[model samples]
Target chain A: MTIVITAFERSPDGGKGLARDTRVRWALEEVGQPYEVRLVSFGAMKEPAHLALHPFGQIPTYEERDLGLFETGAIVFHIAERHTGLLPDDANARACAITWMFAALNTVEPPILELVTARIFESDKSWSAQRMPLVEDRVRNRLGQLSRRLGDAEWLDGAFSAGDLMMVSVLLRLRASGLLDEYPNLSAYVARGEARPAYKRAYDAQLAVNKPTAG
Target chain B: MTIVITAFERSPDGGKGLARDTRVRWALEEVGQPYEVRLVSFGAMKEPAHLALHPFGQIPTYEERDLGLFETGAIVFHIAERHTGLLPDDANARACAITWMFAALNTVEPPILELVTARIFESDKSWSAQRMPLVEDRVRNRLGQLSRRLGDAEWLDGAFSAGDLMMVSVLLRLRASGLLDEYPNLSAYVARGEARPAYKRAYDAQLAVNKPTAG
Candidate 1:
């Protein structure tokens, strides 16, 4: 079956590949799967049609044959489960890898997201300056732990898996803030993820849509 | 094999059942699995021993046989996958159910968590009152979409799977804030979850530890 996924018609990040579709695309590329993208404008995303697929009205939603799914964690996990490239053959290893995926999304990403909301949406708020440190510190605390766990390791667990894919994606959001630079190992880990051939392909694919066109 | 999990020595919520461990406990109950709980103090959770089991230094962590897993989502998922009651047999339905789990943690819970930080951690900040509306609105926005999606449905998907288990747990956080009451359907949905036999057992178990005793 041909897989069809959604992406932003024009990403808010303007081709930085922070938009979530890039993550799904990266997963597909890593697994050597060919999929089609259906772009949705911001207005259309909130429409009933998109809402039917994703209750949160976000991209990207996965559609294959009769099946439809959302949530990058779920989408990526589904892809990883069906494909050989992203998960370990050992059951315990696979479970551990999945744990990292959850940690990346629920634990690591939430604080980073708070930081993003502060920097972007709440920048004009009176508390932005004073509250910024608190938000940043929360992120640092998680990163400090993650950095220690990931010390001298090529990936989160053993070889690169969906766990690394997600950890790297979540960490990517921290790159612009320079928080990622504070931990050399994490910075190197992100660099290693970026260096992957599959990640490069996924990044270029989303960049194509997001990049500005010359008149 | 004996199944062992960890919980807070004394939950910060004082038996309100807001801790993540409650979610895992709920999952185990739903699946009819018997488990043991080891309580960890706040200081102990940050120590290297606890950090070894859970890199983020939070609980509860699951250990059974040779497998040790942290992150409530992953632990709950592991339980659901092994048991019949928490997931559907259909592959597509199962995948969709898992999607809701991620949606609850990643999308819905993040904004709620931000609301929590604002209310609890930053309550004394000068801008707390002014900035709260923005944080609350972000949660309200997600809740509005969720309320609409959940309209007239007993669960997010079908048949009270882990999706409902997780979605209900995430929504429960908003009850004290009175935000949940704004959406009658959501409030009822959470009540429905609480009414389940498994959920009741889970609630009572956590309450036993958290409820204060008179001298």
Candidate 2:
């Protein structure tokens, strides 16, 4: 069965690789999986057909044979569970690796997303200016704790498992905000992730989709 | 090995079963596993000892033998994977179940949490009144889609899997917001979850911990 994932027809990020599909694509590349992408327009995403696959009407919905899944965390985990290279063989290590994945999505990403909402959605609001610092501080607090835990380690845990993949992907969103620079180790960790051949491939692939066509 | 998890010494919700440890305890109950709880103060949660177990410095953290885990999503998932009853046996169904778990935490919960921050953390801010409708509407958008998918169904997918366990838990947070009542099916879905014997036991247990002592 061919694995098919949905991506934005035109990413809001405009090829920055911040779209969730890039993370899913990167996971496929890491696992040596060849997949197909179906681009969905922002309007069509909310249609009943797309909503059937993803109730939230979000991009990066995964379909292969009879199975369909959504949510970047789930897609990435589904890929990692089937791919040997993405998870450790040791039971404890594997469990711990899975822990980091949740930590990235649940604990760390929320504040970062709040910052995004503050900047983009509420930028025109009267209170956006006063609220920016509070939102940024929340991200910094999480980054500080994450940096301390990382503590010069190459990854969040042992080797570069799905945990690191997810943590790096989530941290990448912070680069533009410059909050990540406040923690040098996290900056280096994300840079290391970007340097991976798989990440490079995924980044290029998504960028091509979002890039403007030359005249 | 004994399974030990941490909890808030005094939950801000005052034993409303929203402190996250209740969800982990609920999963354990579904699996018929007895566990011990370690209550930690807010100050201790930020200290080195707790931070080592949970980088984000929040409860509850899971410790069994040498392996320790954190993040309510990860902790609940760890328990669900190691035991039966919480996850389905079918491969595709299992994958879909996990997808809903991610949906609950990543897609749906974020907006609700923002509403939480808006109400509790920033209640005194000048923008709180003006900004609440926006935050609440974001949560409603997700809920509308969720209600559509659920229709008359009892669970997010098939059976009472971890997906429902998580979705129900996540939606429970919205009860205080009253956003859930807008969708009758979602309200009923959460009710079904809370009506479960396992949930009852978990709820009562956490309430015991948070219940104030008589003078």
Of the candidates shown, which would achieve the greatest lDDT relative to the real structure? 1
Q: Which stretches of candidate 1 lie over 4 Å from their true place?
A: none
lDDT of 2 by residue, B27-125 (tens): 999999999999999999989889889888899999999999998888888888989998899999999999989999998899989999999999999
TM-score of each: 0.98, 0.98
Tens-place lDDT digits, model 1, residues B1-215: 88999999999999888998999999999888999999999999999999899988899999999999999999999999988899999999999999999999999999999999889998998998898888899999999999999889988887999989999999999998999999999999999999999888999998998878711
User: What C-alpha root-mean-square deviation, in Å, does candidate 2 show against the real structure?
Assistant: 1.2
Ten contiguous residues with the weakest lDDT in model 2 chain B: B206-215
Give RMSD to native, each candidate.
Answer: 1.3, 1.2
- Listed in order, the DockQ scores are 0.94, 0.89
Which interface RMSD values do the candidates have, in the order shown?
Answer: 0.6, 0.7
